[model samples]
Target: MTIRVVLTDDQPLVRAALQMVITDTADIEVVGEAEDGAEAVRLTAELAPDVVVMDLRMPGMDGIEATGLITAGTGATRVVVLTTFDDDDYVYGALHAGASGFLVKDMALDDILAAIRIVAAGDALIAPAVTRRLIKEFTRPVVSPPRWSELDGITAREREVLTLVGRGLSNTEIAGELSISIATAKTYLTRLLAKLNARDRVQLVILAYEAGLVATSQ
Candidate 1:
């Protein structure tokens, strides 16, 4: 199946460039384009693309607000924030606003495509630098442990997977940490998503941080 994508940017040149790069791939399609955030949201609601490549500095709605609304309202439409600035401040905002990943605009075409594919697969794309900063930026007052109450339906192993995932481990890494197979790790991840009612791993990561599963310790 082709990966349907929507590109949202104030610049026609940049959006066109992205479209050109993505179209080179056989499995990706530029389903539509949006000039600003409001239009991005409207088109997203209508088209329901698999992925949205969002620019941070749009004129009207801006990437941050658009990301929040898009992720909150859409089903299965993952957003990857793109920008020339890696100022670090924007990182938290984008993720908190519901971006699945952040990519510096200068990234290679292949990396950009990979980021989209990663988000579409329901895995987060935050590198260690971003994850560390995001954790520090967001985890101010530590919250309570993840409750067995809300987590009633989750299995013990799934709980284990969530905790490690919350710790920022990838699937391969998580499997090695738990002495399980990669397939088993993915299964646990799937189960965690279902039980926690999380749309994707990004939300799961947020939940873990909120529930005190991981934090920047003293």
Candidate 2:
């Protein structure tokens, strides 16, 4: 199935660069382009694209708010945040706002494309270096209380899957670590998402951190 995508970036060059690369791919198509967050939300509602590549800073709405709106308003569309900044606040905000993937602009165009595909395929992804930073940053004290109670409905095995996900392990990796089939690992992940009311794996990762399932020192 072709993965429909909408590019939302303030810079014409950034949007054009991504569209140029996407045009060469067979399974992914750029369905629309938006210069700001409000336009992105509108395009997402109209196109119902599989994924939206969002930039953080824009004239109005902003990517974080746009992401929240898109995810809340539509079940079929997902957002992947692609921005120049890898700041901790941006990462936390984007994931909290329901982005399925978080990528920095400096990453290779090929990798970014791969990320879009991953998100489109119903999985979530974060840049490796960013994942590491995110894990460490979660150890810091936050202004609001951590929602540890969210994990109450999940089983221990589900908690294990969530922990590995928080550590940025893929389903295959989680399977190997627990000596289970990849399919079983995926099942646990799906259960975690449902039981915890998570939007995606990114939200599960945050839940793991908030519940103190992930080791900060690791």
RMSD of candidates 1 onward, in order: 3.2, 2.3
Which residue pairs come into collision in candidate 2? none
lDDT scores of the candidates, listed in order: 0.79, 0.83
Model 1: residues with Cα > 4 Å off, grouped in runs? 84-89, 121-123, 126-149, 152-156
Q: TM-score of each candidate?
A: 0.80, 0.88
* lDDT by residue (tens digit), candidate 2, 1-218: 99999999999999999999999999999999999999999999888999999998888788999999999993689899976554666667888888887767888989998899989988788544567666676444445666777777778888788888888887788899999999999889878778887878778777777777775577
Query: Tens digits of per-residue lDDT for model 1 on 54-166?
Result: 98887978898999999998388989988754445565577678888877778888988888888887777766455655566544453455454766787777777877877
Candidate 1: worst 10 consecutive residues by lDDT?
139-148
**Model 2 TM-score on a 0 to 1 scale:** 0.88
Query: Which portions of model 2 show Cα errors greater than 4 Å?
Result: 127-130, 137-140, 179-181, 215-218
119 Cα displacement, candidate 1 (Å): 3.0
